[model samples]
Target: MNFDERRPIDILETIGEIIEAAREENNLLKLEESIDILSTLIDNARFNQREIGILNYFLANVWSYIQRIKFPDEEFPLETPELEKQIIHLRIANRLLKDTNDNFKKCQIQTNLGNLFSHIGRFSEAQEYFNQCLEIDQNFEMAIGNRGFGLYYYARVVFDATQQFIFMQYARKDLLNAIASNQVYNEAKYAFAGMVKQIESAYPLKELNDFKKYKDFYKKLDKKEINYKKWSAENKLFINPLNDILTESVVAHDYLFIPTMILKSDDKLFFHSMFNQLKQEFVSVRFLFYESVNSPKPHFSDKEVVLMDTLDYSDYSFTLEKIKIAFRVCYSIFDKISYFINIYLNLGLDKNRVSFRTVWYNNLDKNKGLNTKLLTTKNWAMRGLFWLSKDLHEKEFDTTIDPDAKEIATIRNFIEHKSFKIINSFNETWTKKTETFEIDRQLFYDKTFKLLKLSRSALMYLSFLVYDEERKKSIEQSNELTIPVNFLKIKDADKI
Candidate 1:
């Protein structure tokens, strides 16, 4: 390893070899001595870009590994001053390698930086680094695990509720990708599973996208495709699993309700009719709103859609029309859920007999507390079980649910109060954030999808809650002789 006659590459390999052997033998003093010599060589030499990059990267890698091994049993908060030393080395390495198109070096530096930034809670910068590393190679495990790690923290700090879940969605999505790609970090699985367990214990009725999460993960893994794209799943692309939203509507109905002697034939028809209406709304959403952004068949040309508008007020009506229909579609999915449950509970024969309904019907048609039930039917769980999401299950529900509720709450207010905030997030770290009544196309697309997911989750939970109570009362009655078996067959069809 003589510096006088040897080439720079050979000198670096010699230094790296000594450091590796020292590390392998558990000789901490020798490892530090090797790093010191390598560091001195780097500081004293003036080499070509490739040589300098290699040397700097080696120094950074050695320092970073040494910090982890410094206290083998210690937890990796990555907060020690030694880790900060690693950050400096990696930054120098990244700068030296910037001119060269060496992805391995780029990924190595960026991943270390992401880890340090995440520990410091600078999530925006951390996300940037992790994403950059993944761009070099999606299968890069450090980037994958650290990217998910950054997202989890970002979700914690974000102020907007709807925006928080969007972060978590990406968080869970990528973390699962990291897990499925390879087993580089056994601890990543443990950390992720712990987070999920906490989420469940905190929220009683919380469902992770109906617990059919990240099916896209398997699709990507199956193909062995590095060029795989995300943000394009049929369910994830737009709001409302556009490909199979219809199936979900019926599935929600069957899973939430149980047929009993109290359920009349007309009540069954009423519930079915509500779902049919929901199918229509979801169809309109796909055809009118989602299709416009998803394809824009009429406007696309030369691989981009250029909007050239010369008319002054003409654009106004069309924009308003889009808003009206999109809102209507999203609202219908939500509004009908209340109607469906209300119909089943209030339209039945035993409504007058029950002391409490334990739910509220949102529609004006049958919300009169079932036959005006003469004496008193207590508003047991508030006006509606989910009024302000005040129920026990809602109280224990995950933070994810509230964001959806927050977004949908604003929508409800828009109709009832005639004014609501439509927040348009300009870009990452919010270079421009505004609460304008005017619709930003991309913002609406994102918010609408979140609202759709929330609506589905809430309805499913509500139906389960209401029917669960009904089943309890029915059990007390022991009315097995009068129970309907037809609906029981469909009950297991959508159990989460």
Candidate 2:
């Protein structure tokens, strides 16, 4: 009947009437008919910027609802192709309005683009568009939720074992962000929970120690203990307690103590001096003590007590030796914070910590630090850094040394001032990382001390190369005597 040729107002009126009729009839088929009528109106109408934007919004809502219905096998129906066609039509309608400089229209178009890409299994592309929508309007809950779903799908496509862990990390982050921003997004929340369950199921560690950490996490979440007796578990990733301890020690030293040491010390020499005092204090402490009767001889004699007392050991004598050792190691590593700051200032390294502290303090003052504010910001940064360094050999580098200095200052300020808000904020940041990132004491140690050791070793080798060029030449000569210094030798030497 050439209804599409009708006037714009007439087409809108016709569309409204059809949609109303479909609603009144309560028929799925009629709803489809109404969609078809609206599609035709949108295709033909010479809509203004505002009108096209509104229509695109309407179309987006309709498409989202339609996509929710699927075949018995949980696949989209054959009618989905028609929906995709309508999405393209909607995009065209919005693009025509782009010259009007309408942000709302652009956002709608991007959102629709994200939806279509997601439907077609182009999850990465969908994520791009969804991110564009968020950039236009961060508070757009729908866009946020949709981006979360896009990430979930992208995670599913990841194949590499190591990369799958990282994919799940981003997927979980996006889903959690969606839920945090919009609590009503049940679909996104469900997807996030389901994905976490899948990861835990696939990588179930068999050793009691490895499982204990997850067990503890689940216990804190009030999750029921898994009944291991029921399933025939295979392939356990062994837990190395020493490795765990070293990892956590490194993290804590790098992030916690080092920062504090830097903040407190005036210079490197001062820091090292104080560090030596602390180290001696820690090392001299005889944690194992024994009581002696008046008649019996004392364990080391009064002479030994006087000798040890003359040193820095007497004060910390009652503490556990391991605790003292850890404290000393923490203190020692912390003393290097000044080194990091000096290097950063001289080398023009990106001071992520400076901005991080500024933002953290601002949020703390506003009482917003704990409620997904700092965690989200830090997570974003971590994800970015993780991806940036994924292929690099510097994964174990001490990144927190400079940042931890500021953190220590902030923590000290909060402690001295008795500011509950600051305390709560700091605690929140720590707890959130612990919970989501699987950061334990051992992980912290590794990041701080173990990384420091590795970094120092590398630095020592680099220094040796710089200082002893002759030694390097001699080694190269020795190597050439055994094997020619060709491409393979060069490659091997470069590795060293």
Listed in order, each prediction's TM-score against the native is 0.39, 0.34
Among these predictions, the greatest TM-score belongs to: 1
Local distance difference test, per candidate? 0.50, 0.39
Q: After superposition, how far is residue 443 of candidate 1 from its true place, in Å?
A: 33
Candidate 1 regions with alpha-carbon error over 4 angstroms: 1-3, 44-46, 73-80, 159-161, 183-207, 210-496
The Cα error of candidate 2 at residue 267, in Å, is: 67
lDDT at residue 442 of model 1 (Cα atoms): 56
After superposing candidate 2 on the true structure, give the runs of residues whose Cα lies further than 4 Å from its correct spot.
Answer: 1-26, 43-46, 56-74, 77-80, 97-109, 196-496
lDDT (tens digit, per residue) of candidate 2 on 113-219:
77665664334445657766777777776676666566555544333344344445555555556667654367756766676566556654342113112222223
What is residue 322's positional error in candidate 1, in angstroms?
Answer: 38
